[model samples]
Target chain A: MTDTEPRKESVSCPMDFILRMLMGPWTTYILYNLKTHGPQRFGELKRRVAGISAKMLTERLRTLEGAGLLRRDYEATIPPKVTYSLTKRGHELDGVLGSLAEVGARWEAEDAAARSQRAAESKSAELRAAE
Target chain B: MTDTEPRKESVSCPMDFILRMLMGPWTTYILYNLKTHGPQRFGELKRRVAGISAKMLTERLRTLEGAGLLRRDYEATIPPKVTYSLTKRGHELDGVLGSLAEVGARWEAEDAAARSQRAAESKSAELRAAE
Candidate 1:
């Protein structure tokens, strides 16, 4: 088969498409902000997303809009105010995002526990060396 | 705050961590295969994932293993067989994956419909021009 064949198959596979969409850097962060804080302006997103550059934020918003996950509304006001909000398809991701949040919380807890365990083991080894 | 501060905050956010992990290429493909087909050997995965390089697959597996999302088992058989399977935490992603699949399917259907609609519009425009 041609190289395009596998990519075509990926489009047909729902999991693959979703995974690819989320694979983009800042995609989920933007989505999370919209979900948690509701519609936000460009500057507001840039500030709340934490550490994302304006250029990257703009690119991510465009990508999200293209994917039909979010919408950009430009108000006909002075300076043309723009706000970003989730589309119905984006809101449909709530279940998935919620599940990810649950798993993420577990990962954090496990990571902390592992770190403490390692520290304890190292401390004990030091004690043994002294003894 | 320092640049590192936001990075530190990202570690605490479960959604961010999960998104980062899933962001890696071949991660979801490998996970999808394992989830659908049960445990898989290295060779099996390489063949089944479709278009992934051996090096990339190995790297993705290592990343998944490090994240506690999958377990790599070494079987002491002739030629030394290694199998990979999802861990409890990895399996915990079922809900998220399921939701993603649902959305993905909807996306594909919408995309196909849009393509056909465009095609029909083009055809009518051509007819009008000919008239």
Candidate 2:
């Protein structure tokens, strides 16, 4: 059966669906790869998405595809051939994923400072508690 | 003591910190109001940020402030005047949020269709199992 049927959320918050879809494990990264590469095979995707396990990649791909943010096509010929690409709707999310990538880069650059600050605060709070 | 002591994360993944920060419960909406309204008081903030309680707002505010995304100032006057504003670092996150908002709009528009698709797929899978 075709998976592009339509999926919606009945979460408490109206925006929960979007948040859940984007913030789920490994979603942002998957979308980022699709946005950058246009379309990719399963092996290519697994390699491109660093730190993702094959099982995890497959799960996330299924999740995103179910959400209509991705399209997965299966080829009857060859060794389990499958290709993943973004739908028109999915491509529309490119700008959003681009912004997320930019945010990720900025945070990576500043992670050190943020860490040191957190450490100092934790230490100070502990000292206060001891006193 | 100053709350904006520069809190950071030491998550296993580099991008995890930003994702954790932005994908937190109320971060996007809090930042959204700050972006739209410039600076606002505690009550104003609580009211403007829908579905957020006083305690959650306080916690989220503290978290964002610690992350250097917000500045919270308290006045020693009779009425306990407090105001929150985005710092340069925080305001810099606006473009990222603008894109998120755009993505959110898209999802909200198509949520019904997505939901129907998911339901159909689930029902079909169940039928195949029954057969």
Candidate 3:
């Protein structure tokens, strides 16, 4: 049986391959940006992702492209316009990213409600103490 | 607007939170194992996840539990039985994980076919060279 050690090649199962793809730093973020905002130039992606270094972002983008998860279109202009977008294979991740967004949104709301409830309880306790 | 820089507190959106959760090393594997195999003991989980240290596995489990994504059950026995499983909230990730698996399986199949084609091409080239 192939245990779950992450191997770059000869991957035994699809789950392992996908996990490795998703776990790379800023990988999903890049994918999410492309999926949500559509194709973007290199600079736009950098600004949108926030805090990702130029070198790091470039590396991530290249890696994704190598994995066939994204496409890089280069226009030879004065500065060489480069736009990145998801490939058909890459777009298959739409369902997964969307579901994650749904869950994340729900959890954020629940956490907010819990925080408000805690604040209310603390305020009531302060009032009781004063009384 | 909240850009995609990871913040531990006051997360601005569901997608960011979900991205953070999924990007953690061995996080998805743990979740996938639990989702696929149902509940498992700590030892079983460690073995199944492959290459995860006991300390790291414990930490991942604790974090997931704290986030209300999984549950830990303890049995009072001589050996102190402990089992881990996804919570109702954790189970919500079913769609995301399932979709990822689907994509992975398809990619894996395509990759295998490509590899075989390349090998066949190489063999034919060698035959031509010999002739």
Candidate 2 docking DockQ: 0.19
What are the chain B TM-scores of all models? 0.88, 0.70, 0.80
List runs of model 1 lying over 4 Å from the truth: A1-12, A113-131, B1-12, B124-131
User: What is the C-alpha local distance difference test score of each model?
Assistant: 0.84, 0.75, 0.82
Question: For all candidates, what are the clash counts?
Answer: 0, 9, 0
Best of the candidates, DockQ? 1
Please state the error at residue B8 of candidate 3 in Å.
Answer: 8.7
Q: How many backbone clashes does candidate 2 have?
A: 9
Pick the lDDT winner.
Answer: 1
Residue-by-residue lDDT tens digits, candidate 2, A72-95:
999988688899999987887666
Candidate scoring better on TM-score of 1 and 2: 1
lDDT per residue (tens digit) for residues A1-131 in model 3? 38854352442345656766766667777887888799999999999887779999999999899889999999999989999999998888777777777878888889999999999999999999999
Q: How accurate is candidate 1 locally (lDDT)?
A: 0.84
lDDT of 1 by residue, B1-131 (tens): 55654563652356877888887867878888889899999999998988889999999999999988999999899999999999998898877887788878878889999999999999999999999
Worst 10 residues of 1 chain A by lDDT: A4-13
- What tens-digit string does per-residue lDDT give for candidate 3 at B1-131? 38763352441335766665666777877887888799999999998887789999999999899889999999999899999989998988787777777888888899999999999999999999999
Rate residue B20 of model 3 by lDDT: 59
Task: Give the Cα-based TM-score of candidate 1 against the true structure.
Answer: 0.83
